[model samples]
Target: MDFETSDKVKLLQEQIERFMVKYVYPAEAVAKQEIEASGDPHHEPKVMLDIRAKTRELGLWNLFLPDPEHGAGLTNLEYSPLCEIMGRSPLGARAFNCNAPDTGNMEIMAEFGTPEQKEKWLQPLLDGEIRSCFSMTEPEVSGADPTGLQTRAVRDGDEWVINGHKWFTSGAIGARFAIVMVVTDPDAAPHQRASQIIVPTDTPGFNLIRAISVMGSTHGGGHCEIRYDDCRVPVENLLGPEHGGFMIAQARLGPGRIHHCMRAIGMAERAFEIMCRYANTRVAFGGPIGEKQFVQEWIATSRMEIDQARLLTLYTAWKMDIYGKQVARQEISMIKVVVPNMLMNVLDRAIQCLGSLGISDDTPVAAMWREGRSLRIADGPDEVHKMVIARRELKRFA
Candidate 1:
């Protein structure tokens, strides 16, 4: 893989770096204040709207979509480094309309939606005029196993009726639309018995129960508990083929996991910066904390891990460019396990170094720490990725 950045990618990285410093970082507090005052996590903040406008004006919109006509059309390798810069500020990705759940939903529509679907949904999403979510995990079942899903979508001539309960359906509470995965052929083979359907939020019987908070934050945009109580939509809303939902989910998640790793590396970088800044200025034992051997060790090790994770992410991106996502599964799974664990370590050290301030909202450390914890389970739990890695290894030996 070529290690040198193309001039185009270098320009993108520089632009994103400046945007994050000049705009996103300053807006972070304002966003929080808006969310708090509204007491509605799902409400889009005015500051976010302003940021979105600026991002769109800068031509940074829809950078994740690989299709040139629909988005920036950059290769995965080209997009990886730019995403990392956006990752530095957790909210910056969305400001550029590249945030997850939405990005995954957009990719699904781009790849599978009929032209009409694209015209009504995909275009608005690309334009940043609306948002979306994916609902697949069921609270009552072991969601790690897709075959264990209990949600059902049944056909009725011109319409399909969906009935199920889903929680941790990330980004549902305020999204204008959702791509739902449901069992359409329970009697069929386990893996091939499900399907994906696009459901509008205003459809009858579709309900958002509440935002399910994890580790104390409401995750603005809302990871929610949802119920489709006989919610019905036209047959035209089905995405991909009947009983083909699993493959589509996998395709969406492969890129999703890599994006998480890219952002996790960014989060770790931010934490290290915060750690170093605090270490140098804060005095303890009659000297700067940076003078302490243990603090210095933490800083040095953080640099090592963050750099290593970034290279792994880049390599995965390069492989995807050359061999496609299927051939690069091992590399994707490897970073899925490594990056989150590494970030956990880095964030823990940062929290310790910052003393009480890290645990508090005074710095962004508290929020960063929460996000690192979530990465362990979000896309696929670490255990699931490890299992995939082990199976691939055994195949090698065979």
Candidate 2:
């Protein structure tokens, strides 16, 4: 694959790096303090708003959507590197309006939403005026198996009533709306039995129960458990087709997984840098940890894994760009498994190398660890992706 980046992409990447150093990374501590003080997990600190404003002013906003009229109009391959640069800091994606749930939701709307739907929802989303969420996972059942979903949506007159319990509904607490999956026809084929409907967070029967923490941090816009007790939405809220939710979910998730991989690599790179810095500055016994053999080995290994993951992700992006998401499913699944696993290992080593400080938020390693670990379960989970890869290979051999 020709991985040569254009001058425009390179210049944008350099500009993003400068932006990260000057504003994004520095705002991390300030954002944390604001969240803690406000006692709101969804608190967008003023500093974050300023960064977002600056990002929008510089025309760096909504860089993830591939639609020219809606977003920056860059393809997946072009956006991949930009996303990786944003992934350097936890707040990076939000600064550019390129963060998760929102990105996937925006793509869905851009691709499938009707003109009115796009005008109402997609416009606000692209503008970053309001955030959104995806609710597909259930409190019960293996969420990885989309066919096993139990949330039900039934049509009643001009409205659709949704009933289900959903957890790990990422960004639900802060999201103004959600594109939710519900079974409209369970007797139909497993893959075609469900539908997607937009549920406003303020809908009468829809409930946001509480934020669920991963690795003990509830302030990082924690995953939420939500209940929809006959939550009714207008039939106009239906996205795509009646039994088309599963297909749309699949479409949304493929690119979504790539974005996750890109950001995870950036986080790992940051962790590796921190690990090396700590090794150089922290003296042990008579010399710096960098002088020690085992520490050097860890640093070396981190470099190797980071490089490998980045290459794999780039190849996946390239494949998607040239061959389309469906044709590149295997490569995408491969990185779906590789990127997080690589980052998890690198982060764990970095944590160990940092001693006790790494396990705490005193450094971003701890938060990075939490996020990277959760990724193993997010998207499709490692085992599921492995199954996809193995099946694809076995089919080819057969």
Candidate 3:
């Protein structure tokens, strides 16, 4: 897999590292103060705008997309390391306009949108002038099995009427629009029944129920609960082919899953650094905590696990580049199940090492821990990925 960083990626990686240190890490405190002062969890802080401007100026904008005209034109393998660097800070990805839901949404538009759709939505998103969300999960069904989705979209004259409920629509609070998945052909093949449509946030009958909190915290442009009560949009808003939502979704998630893993490796790396720093300097029982055998073991184990996970992620990315997403499904599923669990373990140990300080907001550890916990179920649960892996493996011997 050539496991080596190319000259191009190395230069980009160096720029990203410096930017995180000089801008993003420092802005964390400012962002928190702004969010607190506004009393809005979904508030877009001024500091974020400043950071976004700086990132665009530095030519770091749209690094996640592969389209040369819209993005940096880097392949999955080339983008992996840069993504990991962004993972270190919570605000890192957004600063460069490489954040989730947006990245995936942009990919869909670039790959499937009509010229008009691209002009209306994709351009502003690429310019960082707007944000977006993906609404697929529901309150009554397991999101892992999307074929069971209950949302309905019925054709009515020149517009389509959509009616359904969705939650965990991440980044919906202030988004300009949403890429919604709804059932267009209930009696068709299960996988072929759903279709994706774009609905503007301002459309009538489209209700923002609330910004649903995760682990008691509602992040900016929160994971939301939304209802489309006969919300209507022009037929031109339909994304991709009719009854092709499942295929489009899988394509969107393939790269999205790898990006999540890449960022997770960075998160784990940050936690390990925090744990080691705390253990080596903090005095306990007349000596540093590093003197304790268990603490030393934790440090060693964290280093080993982080390295292993990173390599696996890189290999999966390389495979995707060489063989395409379909051929790399097994590898993708492997990392999907592996990386988040590794992050959770590393975060737990870091929290333990920091003692009481870790659980508090004094450090990023607690928030990171919460994020890692949610990731286990976010893209797809661990069990579902595991099932994919097992079924693939079983096919070999059969």
Candidate 4:
């Protein structure tokens, strides 16, 4: 229950805030122009590279990983606030090498990979020399229930041949490799039928089918659809134990969900600021919009909702730090559903407050709004999280 900020975390948070203000926020516009000019939604703009360099120089790189040997040695509680700051800008997380798929992939490697596997893939990912993607969702199955995934990985002498169609493979376009989930034991228990394996993007039969659009915009490093038709990797590439994919995936998502919630809170905070500023300054019906009771109510409700979501998220991070991911599953599921819905509401009011400008690209609200909407689906849909929470609560009563 003690969520007090440590001195090291406080210093790091201040440094991250300063970095965001000076570099990340400013670079957003430059990165947008570069991506637009390149005519590719997934293009990694040169300006982003510069920002990454600056983040490294400031020692803000890899803030997400808790491994002392490879990362900042910060706990989930400590990293929570830093994640919120980065969430303020879409480019914020990547600039510091704390972005998703990479973060989750790195954790899996550190926790489960063989030494050789770590040397080849994990090291490059940690160094930010390469990027990665997680391919778990399938086109034919309901993504919410990963146990129903149909991707197959069959043993073939020294190699594992993988055949699957995966979509919503985030960050696949620029990723050098993918952490793929495949059904290796179709006859095994449903929960233990699949295993995770590392598939190099260059491996034979591995294909990046296309980058799927979200809310009409495919942001850089777009979510992708991938086909692995007889894709092969060495036997040593299996992540964790055989038929252990479900366990690894659950572990990966615990922190990932928290990271998403933290960023959503930051996005909501930014939207709230914009909404309040616009309402205070804009004239409506011969008076400032802030003077109206309805506008004031939106501002008040937004502030309350943002703080509520933030406190819940921080509390969850603290629980994960104090207890373990397993013990904090209920809280994780709770925030996964609560924070995104809260964010959507806040963003909607912000958009309404800004009038026509809110829905346009002239401001970041529209883009953030779209991202907020996607948060409901990504990292396990809201319905799935709700089911988890309900099951856990029912077990308590039983």
TM-score of each: 0.98, 0.98, 0.99, 0.98
Residue-level lDDT for 303 in candidate 3: 93
Q: Give the runs in model 3 whose Cα sits over 4 Å from its true position.
A: none
C-alpha lDDT score of every prediction, in listed order? 0.90, 0.90, 0.94, 0.91
Question: Candidate 1, residues 28-141: lDDT per residue as tens digits?
Answer: 999989988988776778998999999999998889888887889999889988888888886878988999988998888899889999999999999888889899999899
- Where does candidate 4 stray beyond 4 Å? none
RMSD of each: 1.0, 1.0, 0.7, 1.0
Per-residue error at 137 for model 4, in Å? 0.3
Rank all candidate structures by their lDDT, best first, as comma-separated numbers: 3, 4, 2, 1
On a 0 to 1 TM-score scale, where does candidate 3 land against the true structure?
0.99
Show where candidate 1 strays beyond 4 Å. Answer: none
RMSD of 1: 1.0
Candidate 3 lDDT over 1-398, as tens digits, reads 79778999989999999999999999999999999999987889999999999999989989988889788999999999999999999999999999998999999999999999999999999999999999999999989988899999999999999999999999998899999999999999999999999999999998999988788998788889999998999999999999999999999999899999999999999989999999989999999999999899899999999999999999998899889999999999999999999999999999999999999998899999999998999989999999989999999999
Between 1 and 3, whose TM-score is larger? 3
The count of residue-pair clashes in candidate 1 stands at 0
Instruction: Score candidate 1 by TM-score against the native.
Output: 0.98
